[model samples]
Target chain A: MMKDEELVIEARDLTKVFLDFWGRPKVRAVNGIHLDVRRGEIFGLLGPNGSGKSTTIKMILGLLHPTSGQLSVLGQSPRAVSVKSRMGFMPEESYLYKYLTADEILNFYANLYGMTGSAKTERVNALIEQVGLSQARDRRVGEFSKGMARRIGLAQALLNDPDLILLDEPTSGLDPIACREVKDLLLALARQGKTILICSHHLADMQDICSRVAILLQGEVCATGSVQELLSTPDTLKLTLQAPSQTTLMAVLDLLERETGTRPQVDLTGRTLESVYIETVSKRKSAS
Target chain B: MSHYFGKSLTRISALAGLTVRDAARSRLLVSLGGILIIGLIGLPLLISGDNTLTRRLQVILNYTLSFAVTMLSIVTLWTACGGVSSEIQDRRLYLVLTKPVHRYELWLGKWLGIVALNALLLTLTGFIIGIMIWHTLFTSPESETGKRQACEQFLLARQSRLPESPISEKQAQASAAALVKSGRAPAGIDAAQVATELMKELKNARFVIAPTGTVHFTTLITTPLSGINDGLLNYKIESSRPERSPIPALWEIQAAGKKAIHLSVTNYPGLPNRLLIPGAVMKNAPSLTLSYHRLDSSSSATLFMAQNGQEPELLIPSGSWAMNLGRGLLMILCRLAFLSALGLTAGCLLSTPVAVFAAFFIMVLLAMSGYVESVATSGAFYIPHEGHELSKTWLDKVILSQFKGLNRLTQPLLRLDPVPLLEEGRRISWLLTTQAVAWLVGLYTAVTALIGMILFNRRELG
Candidate 1:
């Protein structure tokens, strides 16, 4: 929304070929991929397993070298240290040091950003609270549940207050509440003009947050556009309102048939399960 | 510049602290510590040698310290290898690497952390052994003979300087020539062999002094000695002819203008004799002169001072033992640093098991470097058939070349060993300690770390 949009990530024909011991190609994980993510946009990369979504994300994060072609993050090469300093990445799994406590992990990452003293302490504490891991701060990450570990992983990803964030399957293993919290966090980050690139298979989560998406299949982009433009059907329309009487419904169908030469499909509108669950939980919390 | 340096230091320190904390919480540290405690303290108690207390103590120092260093090396290697490879394998390294930290800092931090743990453990074990040595040598009740043995042998670090041999090279050459002319030489005798034989003959040569005769050594030492208040000489002697009993011999030792030490001994022909003289007598002495008189008119008295490496004189103490031990431990820390670099580098490029195995193989190769060097240098890889030499196979050439290259690589590290010096109670000089740091820790570790960093930078963390 805060756009005089500046490009944060630009790729042209990026490719990555994983090689075996003798330099024979084992898999072309990503091939001829092109991408552009701009500031203040939540961009999603959706794909099934082995579809090169993670590989592309890794290339953007500078964790993997592109086999060929040009790719840049923040107008610099993907391997540029300065570019990486302004970027944050959370891999698909909660890849965290098991022997470290949550507080320690956050502190460790904060220091990696050259922060120290009370500045570091405050930032670490803020992140731990932001990720809802304050109560588990002192517990070793090895002892944490999957959800707890994911929370800490998220906390570490934000330690540097990076301008660009890459989150791979960020909602995996998270509960619905936490999942909603993560979506809200991503939107909050985007509102601050922070560019986010998320790679996930959760279409609903992607729909709720991402403004634009690129769907990958077999290391190639099958579709890429704004979620609205891609999901909307120009030939169809839906009405969500209070259930109308038979007379009103018949009048609407007659008008549509006379104008379009066809009757529109009609069905009773129902609230999505996520919304109902959230509403019931909200109500229960207010009552409590 | 200072601000950037401070920030980098802070980051590196944080990573190192995390590494140390991780290792500290693991069961491996506790187990290694337990083993070290048992081995250092229990091994001394378990030994049942018939040797005297001093001999047993020397043996204990030699065995236990060597064992402790070997064990510490294994532990250090395992920690370094597993710490890096496991992080990478579990994808934990991705989190850290994604931060603003430089890749070199991560590897260096891990190495520093592992070395810090090694330092603490080694220092603790060293202190315990030191206390044990102190108790055995001084604190425990001992008889006069036992105390003398400890002082004259194990506890004191004596400096031995050889006095000039009375027999000349010309005389030794004449003797070797006479033996060869008498057809005593074997075929294909080289000049170097002849020289060696001549040196041996000189070492066995002895001089006899009749009544009122004197012998003088014109050039004994070129510099003044320290940490010594007196000189002790162990002499082996013989008589010209056998006697029914011991014969009375009178001797006087004089140096510079100082008063001579006079001694009257009932001399036995085949016995070890000790002579103690004031060190101050040797101060500013242009030469040392001795006079011997056969008090009883039986035969001439003979003195034999030749041995393999041992000399006639010993300077009782040259330096403090505590400083020596400190230097020894410093050398050990340098070696551990080298090993930490090795393990970390291997782990950077391989999986945990493979890295560990590779590091172990390297360690074994380094340990057997002397043997590898002999094989490589002696051209044992070459094949000889039908009384003619043939070139080595390509495979043999490759393996030998690899071993030779490794020898050149690890020789500096292996040469920094301090165990033998510690066991012998010889001072490991500060110069040697500095060399160990420069070559083993600074140079070798830096080169290895550079290679590892390059590989790690290009690595794809998939």
Candidate 2:
């Protein structure tokens, strides 16, 4: 039983070099690295631009092969069907067929997953509703707002009910409401035991949704851990006071330094611009 | 791959249906088709009566069909290119590639849709011609004549039996029969081309028409020659009317009571005046259709099997009795089959219009340049020297063999040309529709498969 069960993906010493005309290495897009993603988890891969994140993703997808290494998905070659059948990918940019309507695009993807006839139509309708695009299901994808396009991309990604979902910058260009919706959808999917690997630079966003995170920098992972484990510093606590004066702040700072052997910073301000904006909008919405 | 294939195919099929609906809604296809229809409607107006108009219309329609088919080929080839390049350039391919679709499926599905578009265009255009043809042949006042006209064009043919043997009496008779049957002679070869084309074309010789009209009352005999220097036989004729005699040799002709037309000879075949009739007057019931074509051998234009200098299909065939539909069908078959191969091959590699244009140029170069270059560079064993016959006739066999290889390449282009193929295809009878179709399909299969492999290999998704 153990022998029959295999790792979903395995990349050993995976490295890639972008070459110029003379066959000399122009840049090392991916340095030597190794990784294996489990069958199911909301695994978060966080990185800034040019951190080899997209490169790694492309290599895993077999769009770009590793320069020197053995890389396989679902215990077969990267090009093999076993992995492709189980896989769904969302790129940093979602370039859908402009001529196709939202419903058509969803239907097309569903068909690629071998869903057809009434089943295809039903699944497509459900996806449209789930993505909050039922209202504009017939709208041409070209006319959709960026958020809507992202939602459609998300819907297509989920069409196959793929065993492994790769979502890159899923909520990169969305309004807060849309962002929250996408996050919730991902969470809901994760709850259903689907393996999802999300790549994004939004640390706070990943922190909220990811059970585990790997932070990459300069073509390498600098840190990897759960949000609480990596972020919670020990022996650090301070009281929030309304309109604390400098003298009170100084006294508290001194007390905190003496007790905790560390100087503590004070902040009298509690609400950020976003908080005020949200509250004002909520109030206006309620009034209307 | 197959699942993705089926899915992608289904999507494209739907896309094709949507395209048809959208295209209809936009009135794009309808407008173009309307223009095509209107243009055909005016074609008959430009000609004089039923028979005349049918002949004119037949030429125009055949030519129009050919041109349209070629254009459609270009369109399909171009669309294939446009689909891929546009997707990548617009960054739209990311949409499908990201899905669970294989690259091959994506390629194949798109190809299917494009070909379907081609078939639509073809059917639409062909229907217009078909309607015009039916109206001209069936509903027109001279329906029987029109059908006979088309038949005559196909049956009557002119060709030389291999030229190395001097144009013999029997061969000359056969050629005369062929020429009269087709209403004209093949183009003649000048001294310059004789040496070159002689080896290349075993049967590629020019047939000449003698000047002046023929008189039924008297016998006129003359010998035609091969080489210009062999000898010249001069002759003259007394026609039934003196006015007819003063007319130019080309335009003048004598009826039954006229004297024997004077005979002349040249370096070609010989003919007896006993069978000579008024060349123009003998054309009873407009005998057949006629077409003029320029040949490499002669300075004057040679006549092809044209019915009254127009489409042979619109004239009398084999004594004006039965309609030989096989001829027209054969021509259409050659065009469709060859063009299919060309279009499909062009479609796969060149997936865009510009790329397809490049592919056409490449294909043309492959055919023409390969032919010319080989002939130009081949080892020269026989440079002509004066009076150097030396009995080295054995070289004929080897040189002819080499020439045949070159002709094989040229044969495809020739066969694709329906009019010529239907006439001369009898000589190359072994290569028929089935073989032609196989050749075409094979070309399409190989090229399309290559295209699929390339696209699939280049594609990547997680």
- Candidate whose lDDT is highest: 1
| Candidate 1 colliding pairs | none
Best by TM-score: 1
For candidate 2, the iRMS in Å is 4.2
Model 2 earns a TM-score of 0.67
**Model 2 agreement with the true structure over A209-279: per-residue lDDT tens digits:** 98777776777667777677777778654465577677987887798789878777755556766457667
Give candidate 1's error at residue A166 in angstroms.
Answer: 0.8
Candidate 1 at B66: error in angstroms? 0.5
lDDT of 1 at A114: 89
Q: Per-prediction fnat values?
A: 0.82, 0.44
Question: Which ten contiguous residues of candidate 2 chain B have the minimum total lDDT?
Answer: B313-322
Which candidate's DockQ is highest? 1
Query: Candidate 1 chain A — worst ten consecutive residues by lDDT sum?
Result: A1-10
